[model samples]
Target: VWHKCVDIVTAGLKRVAEIGTMMPDPHGYRRYCFTPLVAWTADLPEQLMIACVSKSASPVTEATHKQFGDSHSHSSRTGDLTLQRIEQVARGTHPWNNLSRFQREAKTIQLSGVHLPFWRNWPFADPSIFLLPEILHTCHKFFFDHVLSWCRELLEDDLDARFKCHHKRVAVRHFAGGVSHIKQMTGREHRDIQRTIVPMIAGCVPPRFLRAIRAIISFIYQAQSPIHTDTSVKEMESSLQEFHAHKDAIIEANARKTRSAGTKNDFHIPKLELFHSFAAAIRNNSGLIQYTADVSERLLITHCKRPFERTNKNKD
Candidate 1:
């Protein structure tokens, strides 16, 4: 389906470019040719496209055949050919066009047989140009949810007990000058605490956690309402870097606890490895992050869902 769509769009763009049929800008300068920059943005599962392409099966199956010395078990060809790897190649980091570790891996996997159809033609000739990191799912959801999880776990008992009777008062005082009102620390109220309240009570949060919180809010606001200037992009990059640093600090702080917990899953807490996508988005098109942000999707769920439905789901 992606292949077909690309073929049709690429053909149309070429035809219009050749015929000189583009609409003029405000300055009345006619522009005929336009290379459509393709970008794919969705939640992590959809964006990663695990097991979506056919080639993912071949190499693993071949490996199994060699190892077992028995031809009976069909090869289960599945491994990590992540979007990050592809995007790295697109951005000139993964060495797809050169000889390096990435190239070596590509060769080992029989790169020629990789079957992502969009990579075959124009416009999508470069996967990096088309498949972008969506800030909404990548940054907003992960960053905020990670922060929310920590906050809820750390403060839920204390806040509920301490502010049992005066929760509304605290919210009213905090947001007195603003239109917002919060009677309970639930859902968006939790988000609001992370965004607005956390900064105000920075002293209460550990320095490492406070820094991460500030970095996240800064990046999200800047992405949603970008300045559309080079400096703004740089600032976004800086904030993202700071967020990553603080995230590392928090992870390090938890490393000892996680180790002692003796859990097989080493990543006991959320990881900020995906934050690289935010930097990629800044480089590709800084201003466009707003369009792909998670704010709208979150708003849709909050507004569209009926009260009864939410109550029933919670009860179940």
Candidate 2:
């Protein structure tokens, strides 16, 4: 059903890409306009859906759950490669002739069995290139979901207590009741927590664990910077390397756990692997800040939420 919907919506996009469109400029001169999908602003899960990859696979890279924690970036997965895989499955050569065999092949390659994706025929658009990094979900949510959990495991109550005791300042958020008590957390709250988290956990955790936290926080801030240079991007890369080097401390402390079993320590986080692609994304699509979801989030409130709230509760 979702794929059908996508095909319906993207039919026009595919047409536009194939033949281009005609539009008038501000001066009223008609010009040929080539509309290609340059960027797709979505969180990781949605990105997986659009890219037609499995949940455990990365949309941009070849990294799967097993290789997610690798310090270096993996080879990117291009639209051509994805389409080729789909074609292979469709062909159903000797081993993959049967349904079970086909399913197994698709699973092995992490294809979602989406024989025809929305962007399959779109011009000048590659999911690996255009499915850009979003700071709001990728960075802030990752900190709150993964890093904060590890901190809580190590520091326990002391982590929250430290947040409670931290001195307040003008224009800075002070967690008077600590973060744990907060029933809901927004991106703003996530930023506030990240702003003070490194210092708050200082001297409380092991040296490697503290270093890991510091490095990731640094990477997030650097990635969010409004402007970027070659040097700045390199610095971001260095910060990620530092974090990966020290991340074992979290596993050693039993802070990181397997999501499925929860019995064993693990570092196979997809978001962490997503970090490796940011530098390339910046080069390909300019600064990461340009693709942030903050603006869209604000628009959602103004355009969707307020309008819906004014409607009657009974499906108005």
Candidate 3:
């Protein structure tokens, strides 16, 4: 199924390439000569990865294969590399070479001719290039889930008890007890924090904490900007460096508070390393990375769900 899909897509691309070559523009500008490139973007979802790599063993698929399919599946095995091992193996370095062993092996996928890995070959550009760090998922995990959540924990009680609006004959209970006890904020709640709480607490929290928030938000906003250039990439790198420095300082100061507060949880934030990976993705192919964010997918899913809800098919 995977190879078939690849063949169909590649065949279409080949025809397009041929037509592009044959067609001539009046101004001698051949727009069709420009080949199309594509990348598949998704969070590291287990089942999706299994399907992409053809490791799933569902009975329906097995049954369909048994009756009519070729006896051999495409090179379906990687000696010892499993999906779960990728993050550990990659070590936040060259995502293509370090993450997928098979992708590294099939360094270049030709649009024409035989595929080295018969089963799963990329039809467009190299799979390594196609794999991108989704900003919506990755940034949210780092900035909101990890960084903001930790900040909330450390500041919530204090903010609730002490921080007040400027015109403070009245107590501002916007965050009465700080956000520490609350679970990770929802997307809407996170926005509310940015809109309402960020300015409110700017003077209250350490300058470094505010700087970190601003830095992360700046990177995210810059990434979403329509403008693309080397300068944007450099800007993101600079933002990341600023974020890292401020993050380390905040963590160091919080270390003592965590120790004294009798909390068993460490101040460590998960997937902070992915910022480097995300930046690398941008460095490798900024144009492609721009399109890989999860914003479109989330919107598409919401659009698709509405019809199901209207038909009462989505009722729980």
Candidate 4:
């Protein structure tokens, strides 16, 4: 329970002088506090945050200082245009990630939140789609690392913290184990699956490449080896670290409350208990440091996959 003035914020003080001061609100402060840990939290697109801060600043001059900032007089023309660029990007990339156009036309498709933003942009729609192989490779490696890391721990409970990669893309992921090899049999079978899944792949590939990927998934589901993805193992770790930091913030807040008010805040005491319970839940879910099956299943089961898979066959 940190008192309001306890200043529990403990991230990116180093870049402070460069990015400019945070807005005077709690969320602004929270976002500012979370900045250095971006590699860890993996939240917000690059450059967009600087844009967000600029947008949030109450007085335009203060916002300008926060944006192009650390530059000469806030009145100067140089900082104005420089700060304006980030806004331009956010505005431009908007359509790339949203699927409403297709859905509105009765496409009636659902893209995963993870892929939705990406699909709204360029490479995702261009069919000439770049990074197909990279995406596959990364997904495969992410699953493999977490699965093996998990298996090792199961075989030897003496160990904790099994993941190794600290990269951004993969660490934020949740990959189900064992599904790596499950494959569809026919081209038609895969075609149907593709109709359903291709959108989730974030429109990040050409039709021809997407077809090829479907073939690969089918073959592997029926075979032994696994296909990888473009996302890195490091990303998964980064996500967990971010999650932990968030959890830690909640814990700190509760601790501060207890100290700040003592008996003065009895009316809201139950809310405090609920907050502690929430923090405990996150702690119980302590993210995997080395990949593991249990964690993988928990993380990978998205909103779409209501009938989640749990095959003990994977252990074999």
Q: Model 3 compared with the native: what TM-score?
A: 0.54
Q: TM-score, each model? A: 0.54, 0.91, 0.54, 0.17
Which ranges in model 4 have alpha carbons more than 4 Å from their true place? 1-12, 15-38, 41-83, 86-316
Error of 2 at 106 (Å): 2.3
lDDT of 1: 0.47
Per-residue accuracy of model 1 over 1-316 as CA lDDT, tens digit each: 5545665766766455345466788899976656454455555444333223222222223321133222122333223333334444445533435546544454443342223344343432333334455555555565445555454434444443333333355444343333122323433444455455454535555787678768867876676555466777668767867765665544544422222453221222212433434444556655555557466566666776655565657654
Between candidates 2 and 3, the one scoring higher on lDDT is 2
On TM-score, the candidate that comes out on top is 2
Question: Residue 8 deviation, candidate 3, in Å?
Answer: 7.0
Model 3 lDDT tens row, 172-245: 33554445556655554554454444565567677887787677777766665555778887797688677766
lDDT of each: 0.47, 0.87, 0.48, 0.27
**Worst 10-residue lDDT window, candidate 3:** 56-65
Per-residue lDDT of 2 in model 2: 82
Q: Model 1 — which ten-residue stretch has the worst lDDT? A: 56-65
**Model 1 alpha-carbon miss at residue 3, Å:** 4.5
Local error of candidate 4 at residue 267 (angstroms) = 54
lDDT (Cα, tens digit) per residue for candidate 4, span 152-259: 222232211111222225424322221223332322222233333323332433343334334433322321213222232233233333333332222232221223
Error of 1 at 311 (Å): 22
**Model 3, global lDDT:** 0.48
Pairwise lDDT winner, candidates 2 and 4: 2
